[model samples]
Target: MTTSSSDSTSAAASQPGRFRVGVQKFGSFLSGMIMPNIPALIAWGIVTAVVVNVSEFTEAGWEPTNALAGVIFPMIHYLLPILIAMQGGRLIYETRGAVVGAVAAVGVIVGSDHIIDQFNAALPAGEDQLGYVHMFIGAMLMGPLSAWLMKKLDAVWEGKIKPGFEMLVNMFSAGILGFLLLAVGFFVMAPPINWLMAALGTGVEWLIDNSLLPLTSVLIEPAKVFFLNNAINHGVLTPLGTQQADAQGSSILFLLEANPGPGLGLLLAFSVFGVGAAKATAPGAALIHFVGGIHEVYFPYVLMKPALLLAMVAGGMTGVTTNMLLGVGLQAPAAPGSIIAVYVQSLGGGVGNVVGVTFGWVLSAGVTFAVAAVILLSSRKRDMELGDQFSAAIAKTEAAKGKSSSALASLSAGVPSAAADRIRTIYFACDAGMGSSAMGASVLRNKLSAAGISDVYVTNKAISSLPGDADLVITQQTLTERARPKEPQAIHVSVNNFMNAPEYDEVVELVQQSGDDQAVAAGSEAPASSAEHASGTRTAVEPRVLTQDRIRIRAGSATQEEALREAQEILVSAGAVTGDYLQAMRDREATASTYMGSGLAIPHGTNEAKSSIKSSALSVVRYDGGVDWAGDQVRFVVGIAGVGDEHLQLLARIAELFSDESKVAQLEAAASEAELHALLSGVNDN
Candidate 1:
């Protein structure tokens, strides 16, 4: 069922091609900083648009009212830059880095202002003073730079401080570093950044003046397909566009990458002329792409046939040219590049502006649709002969994006049954392959083993290390997107909690069904059912892991962190692990929630912290009032410290005990610690 033809494209994405890895990583980093601050940018845009008309700003002797000047100017000059710096700093060193980054940003802001004031003072009496230079580029540079320096400084004396003087030394060192960085940012960083931004702005203006701006579509359309749309639009273009908009009240740069017309047209062409699953899904994908503002929906279509890239480029050029000729522009960056966002930003520029922008969008889509239709028609015979390439296209798209996309997943929902039958290798991925993914892999492995599904190879891996040949990939919902690109062929699954996700049972059922289907297809007697053997062996045995003293019923409610600490204290008190393991548990939870679903959460230290383990042990606590474990109601909390696979036997038994709703109810209703212990220990008997 796999498309062998896509192997080349998939390999290309897995390796490197025209795009440099360093450049992509840098673009991703820039978008990471800018994406979080988009709300602030949008708000600033709306306020500016509403306070004074953009058309009026173009007239001679025009000036903003005090309300507009007071709110609008300060937001671009100060608030936005500080927020961007804080986010950039946080990315580098967490909250402490964020504080230092903000401090450093302020220094650059004031320095740029000082430079502007000096230049304005030198201007002749009749000439207008130069506009204030926004320090966006300065913030982007100083934020991560200051935070990284702070981190390096902290590493110098880490764990070397004397007992109680640790706090004093840490506080003074960070303060001194922040102060010095502020001075450096003021003197050394601001001037060059301001000049660079000005130079870039001038370059963009030159392109527009020469009517060569449309040619940028050659780069932008291709980059968008490679998943650099956000990085290009939000990271580089938005900052430059915002500056232009502040001065001119509108900027064509905002429309450069944010125009949704080309994507809409490409999707429209697919809807009309595509084949198989792609044809069936194209209409829906087009809707999501054009109006929903998720441009990713169309990327897979382009990746399916890279020849379509030319069509996208042509469409993009047409949009840009139309906007340029009509003198139409957005008051702000049209985030998500949706038609709605474009129209909203086009307001306050008068009816002519709105009409012109709309016309440009329509023309772009029309041109792309025409070009893409011709391409699709030309290849219609070959495409039909090749069968559906939708799945392969999705794989390529995810590979290029460096992550799985939900939009792409929705397109392939009709064919899960086909993918399920071929499931042989499954991967459980997480940020670090040490804790959550490992535990999840263990749980799924146990399930598969019980089902006599020894043919399936299940293992845990860091998302970055996923092998491409996996048939199925399971990840935390938050990380599914990140895990997708690593193994584009895998049937990716997302779960809320790794421990007891309900999806586990469904996956087991799917495997069982697929096995049966394969046996029937081979025209042989189906293999003996393992379910009977598994169910019939429910006999009681002495509980080595669950002692009466270690079980607690009707424990008081606590926060998720407090519950984790309680679990850690119990394990520590039992002499199973060192006190340092508590921090490891906290660190593991920070990476991913330990919630196991089914009113159960198993809190454990990471694999790296296994050195702190003294012995294998388990502690169980039942919170009748219920503990909120990361938005899930948890009635049972289990703390585990395993030497190796010794703890997994009991852990598997616990998973089985929680798998049934009736048994879970019995455990929950247990009145005393002894009753709960007996009920838990009964899993071994079953």
Candidate 2:
């Protein structure tokens, strides 16, 4: 989920007497490693759910079909372990480590009583027993061990190995270390791990026999919100479910964490009764949660209102109870906790299973909504006016769009004065480092560049991979607790919208006014040109490309092209450009619509039309009645006039501004050039 970076500091992890931060960090890293393997895990589940019903083949007189199931099961059985081990090693030391981890896992795959007996004694008649190697267990153990061993060997040989023969030494070193770990896995680890596995299975069976399985949600629901769901689901529940499925043809364990009912119920309730952005964001999240199977979407909502955790717990227990009462289970795991995926996995379990799952979903949703509504209504704080929350939440919702919500109600609360300034390095973090967080980092990097702050290095990282040297940190509100424990010394800045100009402006001002108390960076020299004016203020200049005459508000036009033309005329009238640039703009539009989300569109000419430009300029045309641009209702059309690459930075700033709904709302409502110019003021290109 996307949230303002501003609300991060108040996360439970940031509070005292909660779970230790280190444990949370480990959970984040472990889950992150397992994230990429979910599809493969679900594929295995699908085959068991849809394709491996041997009885159906026998009834259809297609005995050969059963043979296909036999071939697939073995591969599926070993695939998860191999992949998990590979990912685990890759996380630690990259490709070489992954290779060593995979090689070492083979020993664990075959190390058990059956394999051991092959060398000791022959089996009696009718006793062709299978090996009891704990594949998942062994992989988890040997993967890291082997990777660590290989890393150590590399360190020892780093300078000793001949330069020309480095490849030979590195390859041989990894191979030898992996071989050693394989021996350890088979001879020293397998038997005890198998015993532990058996004990866990038996205890779980005991709980199921007594109808106490649903109580597990007391831990599961809370852990999930804390970003520990992957560890619990993949590392714990999945292995248990696989065992039950192997023995009894299905497992309720598979449905425990994957059930979508609880999250859906919470979202549905928030959509109806939630104050602020919660009401607007919840319904969409509900659909995504239940249908799209991205359960992560709802975690921030739960985190926002910790009381909602109870609602989730109650709903989870209800789903588990319903499944238990109906004697329903899935043949395989559901990849996403989505209803569609659950239904697909339920095929092997029959009509009863589908009905059970549906009933559980409905019951859980009903229960959760009731519980959540009661909590929201009863728990209003003295300082908080419910109506004010709604208003503030809406603006934040607009600013963040659909990414994340405020994790804390008091996002503007103060931090320690000693830690407020003098940050030399900035890190933008998120669940995955490749998406919005990366864009946020890029935005900040450009801002710092424009400010002539060459000493401050800006970078992006996954929440789990934050470096020790980071001086300032930024992340979504939901993940603040998860990230804070990693670097408590850094000046953490939480924000609702990475693209919000005000938020960037605030950070830039903080960085500009502060001294660098940390050691001087290697490139502490100032830039050749700075974004500061003679008045001694560092401001974003992207909006400077616009003159007062270029900002206009007009009635709706007949078509998208007419709107584009109207905006084009603003730049022409302002004497910002010359020649026929309209065709190139239209030509660019023909290739792809310029309608950026959040009720804004940016129309510009392609590189081929650069010759038509007389100067670099930006124009804003607001349509009060709104124009339809490629099916999207656009209220603001930003026309660009570029000479060479001068407009690219302006374009980036515009994209950032449009991403914040509240800002877009203000821009759309502006009546004069001053209001429009003020709104676009702090946004600029370097």
Which candidate's lDDT is highest? 1
- Candidate 2's residue-wise lDDT over 626-665, tens digit each? 7777556778777877654344444445655776667777
lDDT digits (tens) for residues 1-686 of candidate 1: 12222243565664564354445667877887887788898888788776666436555324554346568888988999999999898777666677899999999989888889999899989898888878877888889998889877876765477879966986798788888888988888878888988898889989999999999999999988887665667666888888888998888898988888998898888889988888888899888888888988888899889999999999999999999999989887777778899998998587899999998989999999999999999999999998787877776676565444567667756744556577666678876554456567767867877877655556666787776867778887656656666775667777778877666776786577566433222102212221212222223333555577777765577656557767887887788889788778766675567777788888877657879889877889988888866446888888877675445445546766776689889988888888887788754453
TM-score of each: 0.76, 0.60
Error of 1 at 559 (Å): 14
Candidate 2: residue 323 Cα off by (Å): 1.1
TM-score (C-alpha) between model 1 and the true structure: 0.76
User: Candidate 2's error at 280, in angstroms?
Assistant: 2.5
